[model samples]
Target: MTEKPRMDVHDLVSEIYARDSRRVFSTLVRLLGDFDLAEEALHEAFAVAVEQWQHYGVPDNPRAWLVSTGRFKAIDALRRRVHSQDVREQVSKRLDELSQVNAERAAREIEDDRLRLVFTCCHPALSSEAQVAMTLREVCGLSTEQIAVAFLSAPATIAQRIVRAKSKIRDAKIPFDVPSVQEFPQRLESVLSVIYLVFNEGYSASSGESLTRADLSSEAIRLGRLVMELLPDPEVLGLLALMLLHESRRAARATPEGDIVLLEDQDRRRWNRTQIQEGKELVERALASRRFGVYTIQAAISAVHADAPGTAATDWGQIVALYDILLRSAPSPVVELNRAVAVAMRDGPAAGLSLVDNILERGDLAGYHLAHAARADLCRRLGRTTDAQAAYERALELAQQEPERRFLKKRLAEVV
Candidate 1:
């Protein structure tokens, strides 16, 4: 047998940062009882790991090591600060409790810390807008830029919202406990939206070398299952079904080398029938309830595509109807862009181009790359080469993900 390659300590730490930084941060929040303090401790622990791990070698349990180190760092910081008599005594008491809690793992949080953290961030104390921004920024590890893209707002605005949310949590001393079962309904919408946005980031990474991040999408699906099990509501079922149906296409979504395979171009034989069937069943149940939301309607649209054996067989008319319903329910520029694409399939390029132009003229999705890419495709189909080239160029400029950028370049080249 060949010898196993030795991994660099730095690379290992970086990999762990990508995978478990948020996880460790969540646990640290539980241990230290403050988001800002926990965040600082997390970075300090990782920095120390880089220098120390080289000499000590990789620990058998890196996460545990990081957590322990973070806790020590926080305690040291607290010790360094001078406080009033009452404040000092309170700090001493809290530190004693922290040490006791660390020794007794059974006393610690039994629930998934991320789940608890998400619910905590979604507390009614924060506004709905702040809740989404805070969870996406803190819990999901999304950049403020990514959160802004999801919200179609300015990055600075999203950043301020997150800052304000964290300050409120700290000032109010919000209990980070997982919300009770009854409180799930009140916070369910915000939680579901955040999960789906996480799924979106994974399904189509907003930026990065890879087109998809399987870990993020898988976690989103897992959360969806947990939510459905606890809530068993129509919208929850609908959201889960929507993710499953989209995930079912993952295998056929890209080439082995990681180039994107557009939905119409992807090979149907590679689709996961099991997920498709399960998603379709859930969608049916959710639709039957008539209480399903936009997610259910979107899943119904995906079900229409799943039933088709090929792109040509896809019932675009039915999809357009679903889009119409979805637009009425949600009414976002993104939804309108999607519906315009569907209308192109049902009618002709000219018809879809007209709708897209109307949307653009209204100053909606002006900065969204996908909107330009869709416009490019429609223009290309209509033999409007100049318009296609300009649209493709705009998309290429705005696109971040490498695979998508490559695809745009290829389309731009074709027109040139």
Candidate 2:
């Protein structure tokens, strides 16, 4: 059989960014001397790449080409903005100097630029939300629209957040370099959360045709791996494991027509055994450390799912026990709701209904779709078709993702 040439779009995109991301980002940072402007310039450079790559072919040194192009574009932009003769001259002189940079210096400069960008995006000056938005947009190459969707906010709001975050970083004079080991722990949680958000967005896309956003999930995993390589913490290991185990079920999470598949009904044969094995190893390692966090606990839950051969074979009692521990560690309405599901599986639907009713009565999850979905399921099981239909309608209204909404609507149809 003849071998067919294959081009991996994901790897191609990653390589293009990796090679140019630092140098181009640095050029913009140096040229505009602002994180926001540098980020904008980098976006502009990639836009041009998308346009030119079809005809020109990817350059031998695509990174260098992007850096050079972005630099000139930024210089032109700066020239247009500056009316002052002195400022123009300063910009021109800096441009000329950067153009004449030596090879060794360029390497060092690019490294400095990347390091500066990473720390700047994660600066203590910005709020955690802003830091996450800025880092995903600037460093991770996600569009503002994509970011806004991920954050469940308006695009304009996300844009403003990024702009404000950049301004804060500049005004606060946040150091461009990576923090020392002594300062790592203080900033670690924010970084981990951002990575976790990335994985989640992929696991269930905020708005997309597909059930799983593999790119976002893979990017999160990649970033997680990078962080673990740089600093191996138990929590980081746990997060990586969690993402992997969830991702392993991607193939079985939806039907051929793209309808949602509940975990119980998903074909176990379709799951990625390799990812399951890898995630299990990570969980075991994390448990051995005895220094696990919320991510580890969540990973442990996923590990239980992976261990079970089938839905009927699952240890619901063990799952309920884990949820109890999780409730103590992370007292969230979502955790409680999940516990209710486990209770239904272990004890009975009536018991689960009581738990869900208690949560809903408190108005803690007034707009959460899953809460309604859980109620609908329990009501349906108890032969309360009218109540089940109402609950499903509520779920459909609150559901953000199309697939989830469709799933709820289908459930409503089944009862009505």
Please state the error at residue 403 of candidate 1 in Å.
1.2
Off by over 4 Å in 2: 1-20, 23-119, 127-129, 141-161, 177-186, 207-210
CA lDDT of every candidate = 0.84, 0.80
lDDT of 1 by residue, 1-416 (tens): 12223458778889999878987888888888888888889999999988878776777668878888988999998887747988799799989889886622431342366667877887878887787677767776778887676545699999889888888888888888776788766677778887787688779877777878776687689768866764678999999999999999999999988899999999999999999999999999999998889889999999999999887889999999999999888899999999999999989889999999999889878889999999999999999999999999999988888999888998899998
The lDDT of model 1 is 0.84
Which residue pairs show backbone clashes in model 1? Answer: none
Backbone clashes for every candidate come to: 0, 0
For candidate 1, the TM-score is 0.66
- Which lDDT tens digits does candidate 2 get at residues 26-104? 5467546677666667778877866666555666656666776676677677778888889888877877776675423
How far residue 34's Cα lies from its native spot in candidate 1, in Å, is 8.1
In candidate 2, how many Å is residue 92 off? 15
